[model samples]
Target: MEKKDGSIDRKYIPILVLLFMGAFIDGLDTTIVNVALPTMAMDFDVSMSNSTWIILGYVLGLAALLIPAGKACKNGRVKKFFIAGTLTLLIGSVVCGFSKEYAFMVVFRTVQGIGAAMMSAAMPSIIVRLLPPDKKGIGMAAMGGASGVALILGPTLGGFVVGVASWNWIFFINIPFGIVLVLLAMHCLPKDGVPDPSKDPTPLGAVSVFLTVGLLLVILQNYGDKDQGVELMIACSAGALVSLIVLIYSIKHDRERAIISTKMVLNRDYILLGSAFFLSTMMLTGTQYVMPYWLQISYGMSTMESGMFLTISSVAMLTIVFWVGKLVDRRGGRSSSIAAQLCRLVLCIVMIVITPPDGLLILAAAMVFLGFSQAFSGTGHTTRMIHHATPGYEDESTNFLLVINYAAAAMGAVVYSMIIAITLPETTLLEIADYTVRMTNDAVNFTAVAGIAFLVLALVLSILVPNRVPDKSGKASEASDAPDNASE
Candidate 1:
């Protein structure tokens, strides 16, 4: 149960496979669900505004719960958490496949998010603990590569399913994947990294969850189809404000048990990289959120066609990230990250200038470059974050990535929803297909502005990061007394 001569302990390869599966499914779910939204809307008899909750709800559930569950990950329950999570996700997927009502789908998606949070909270820590320093970069990259594959194939795969089968297959497809992962977890996984059970979760943390959810709800409700939800928006805003006050009080008085670890937040590496990640999420994943709708609604593209086009970008992303991860290992994350940001900054400019009227090839070129930019930046940042993880705080470090990533996602959904709702506030999307081209351009223009703002901020913060992994005297979080890494 330790690192061998120049590779991972062979006994633990099964565990690594399970961990990779976990990463793939979690990442797959994030991107795949977006492609099916239009079909789901028709099947469930809901408006475009309501259909979007399928996306927002999953991000919300994951964002709100990851904080508490993150700390709880140190509670010696890794296997149980992972098993329960996969099972819950399996059940939720099956249920989602059979969702007869919009309410049922939203609820199941939320359930899936919760399960994903559990799996995500545990996987990185395990990966970190198991690998030697030399491979951590590759391990992170490999895990990321799995997600990148999911990102690359998600829309296309989901679209294919929607085209060939029903959208229900999107969820149902996870069934066999989940079954194998669960069996492997039951058999070969080791109970290493036993967490301190005494570190009980505090109620103060729960309040922050409520506050986070309320804020997201307000954002969604305000931008919702004009037919309904204004009253609910006001109520959520009030509730969020009240919770914010209570959360501040709790932070001041019981700082030790606050929802987020103030110490972890203050960690210099965490701050720099976390800020960069937030901005990237808004720009990268935000585009993932809106582009499908934009394609279908504006260009009258079929779900399958949109998915194929989007796959171009994701393919670019996967290739760059895989290669750049090696570059991060050889050089460092900061340099790789800054370069990626510059690439994206230029892409934003192109978006602002090119406009959809420039035609499909032009747009497709921009998408490919955007994916390349993400691969470089996202891969480096993740390696840097994992490189900086302090023992006893690994879970927090991992959770920091998930929180900002999903929080930005939830925020992006709200912002994009607002953009679409404001520009084309019609209660019906049926006619949006024939809506004026100028309106679509206006929305894309505004989106470019938002992208520019977030990307600029990301570059500024990323520049301040150290050009190399910060020095940590401790060796790898090995499973047992192990030798220094020889793989390098």
Candidate 2:
């Protein structure tokens, strides 16, 4: 069953497929509803502000449940929860498609979010648990690549689906894939690993919910034209601030028993990995969120034309993740990440000189490079994070890494929004469609600066990444680590 490289046998392929299925759905679910919001709001007879909850509710659910669901993975219940989560999402998606009321839609979406949290939290731990060091990056790559592709394709695909079919069809699309994935996961994932769960939920869970959800709400308010009012936003922001203080206090008081441990809090490598993920995501989302508007507004391109440009960019990213994952496996995290970061840095620097019409072809070329860097660096960071996953807290480590990604993306949206607001005349996202070329050009200029700063920060962090995981024993443990993955 062993390969000459001291990796697991080919049997892991089916397991990898199952894992990717979940990951892809999780990524797609995040953005698939975005393009359909306007139609959905009208169909449900709700204002755009109220309809926004459909997105907010799902995101809050995801943030609230991530840590708790991750904690559940600690006990040998990862497989149990994984299967349960897939089923929950499957059912929830179908129900969401059938919803007759906005409340029902929100509730179903929340259910899907809970399920996604479990799958996302459990996946990295399971991947690390299964693959040997030599092949581990490839495994993580499968996940990262599937997710990256989904993120790229979701909005475009959602719009196409909505144009041809009802918005409900978007939710329905998951049913067949979810059903097959659930079955494969149930049958193929290694027998459940040893569960080492604590009985108490502790104050940490509630605090995390408050901090993550509250901050997300505040971010959402600023990230868009949602005028939820100054007072309400202030209240949400205050709640989030208090929650952070409570989290710090808990970590300080109960380092060992706390969900957020001092070891994790203070670890240098973990901090670097988190920074790399956060900053890289900020660059990605900031650019991606702006590019479509920049194209449509600045060049007077149609929606479909701008979408095609993005698709080309995404296709490039989609192609690179696969091979970069293998490169990560061979080169190790530090080298791969550093190289990837450098590539991204070059792309951002080049993007500064790009303008509409005269620079369209050049921009497309830059996008190709952008996609490549996102994939390579993304896979590298993922590989390192998984390889360095804390022994006793594999789930927690992965959970925190993913949370950093989420937070960074939200931050990117808010940051880009602030830049645009400061640079351009006031315009809602809905109204931004009609923005003048001058307004769009201003947004692009500001976005480019922000992207450059983020990439620079990420590059510095990547330099600090340990080239490879330190094998303290300094001997081949490949054979030894093999069986542990099967039963640990």
Candidate 3:
């Protein structure tokens, strides 16, 4: 339903529910499988290395398809894709639950990942394309909150499922729940746009993107492994470079139909926003990778206790996203984004200074601020990108955003791991059983200092972000004008 004063109409509630569920399921699968990995490994008689492929398989499949799927959301039949994605995930999950072989389990997980890619690519773009300017923030907040909830609940739910039944139930649980959501989505989702053949992304463009992402992920994941051959890394690096070149050619050949649009690639504000987003994601992943080790080592806390403490951060994020949505609506994306970076700046400083035990309260405060930073920056950058996107290309812009997020996650973990490895070659973070509290603080401080450098760069970029892009006539346009009535 359309409203007069920018408030959500009653008719839109079903759509929001579907979006939230889609995001929640996609995110839930990411973490829920972790708790089941040991059980899965035992059941399948596989080594830990082999079991890791289950996670890697899904990530590779999801990351490779995200960009192509984003284009499909705009130029292809979206409703059909959404249904197909859900059904695909359902089938994969059921098969995964019933699998007698480890290889089959990994293959089906990849299938589930592809399905997730379709849903994730379409969901955020739906908010931008389908909702009004004032209402888009609310939709984004709902979607973001779903992710936060998934993060908090996934492991706990996984543990409970494994405790009571076979680990396969984790996948089995999605069956009934997914089916209901799919039916609801079919009824509530907006009608799909007509397929535009002329705007179809080229096969070469899709292949290039797939190869580039897949190779990059592989390289990042295997970078420091002694078992991984240098020749393999070199080959993958070359393949990625070639794929990037092909992508550049495809974009130049057909900017309108390329996986990534030329207008977005060339836009200064888009680049700045993207860079800031990438850096922020890196900061988050780096922190996540290191924090658990620091907590258990320095605080003398058990794994469970450390996990429970970390949950507070997600709780903070989940709580603030609801409020940040309204704040973005009132203050605008640029202002909110700048505030987000400032929050990150403070978080980094706090992490640098706060010691464990005595500074536990300060550390908790920093974690809360970290959540606030994430909510503001994540939502603000998204809205800003929507605002500055070229007219008729808002959906296409989301492809770039999702691609950057995937790349940053992979890169962040590897980059920070490398930094730590280089700094303390004598002992790894996990092997620091004999480390003093002071040594642990030094390590965390080192990471925090690195985080500060990145955050500073992001802050500068956030400051440079403009409100909107100018049209051919040199007049600036409102983001709402881009696809204001496209959904209708």
Please provide, for model 1 over 307-377, each residue's C-alpha lDDT reduced to its tens digit, 9 standing for 90 to 100.
Answer: 88788877888777757766665556776677667777666676668656446676788787887776776
What does candidate 3's lDDT look like per residue over 247-315, in tens digits? 889989977777777776777778889899888777876676556557766887654455556666677
For model 1, what is the alpha-carbon lDDT of residue 182?
86
Clashing pairs in 3: none
| lDDT values for all models | 0.71, 0.67, 0.71
The alpha-carbon deviation from the true structure for residue 228 of candidate 3, after best TM-score superposition, in angstroms, is 3.0
Worst 10 residues of 1 by lDDT: 478-487
lDDT (Cα, tens digit) per residue for candidate 2, span 1-488:
23668565777878678767888888777666755665676688764334555665565566667666776665577788788888888788889989999889988888887787777777866765665545666667777777777766776776677777778888877777778877887788767766654532356745666465647555564644544567767777777777777776765665554666556556777788888878887777666656655666677655445555666656787887877776655555666676666766666766678676668887778778777776776687766775565555555787777777765655665667666655552544334334577767767787788888887888888776565542322111221112222211
Candidate with the larger TM-score of 1 and 2: 1
Residue 386, model 3, lDDT: 66
- lDDT for residue 69 in candidate 2, whole number 0-100: 70
Q: Which stretches of candidate 2 lie over 4 Å from their true place?
A: 1-8, 31-59, 91-111, 151-156, 166-168, 191-200, 223-228, 252-257, 300-304, 346-351, 388-391, 429-433, 469-488
Clashes of each: 2, 3, 0
User: What TM-score would each prediction reach against the true structure?
Assistant: 0.88, 0.83, 0.82
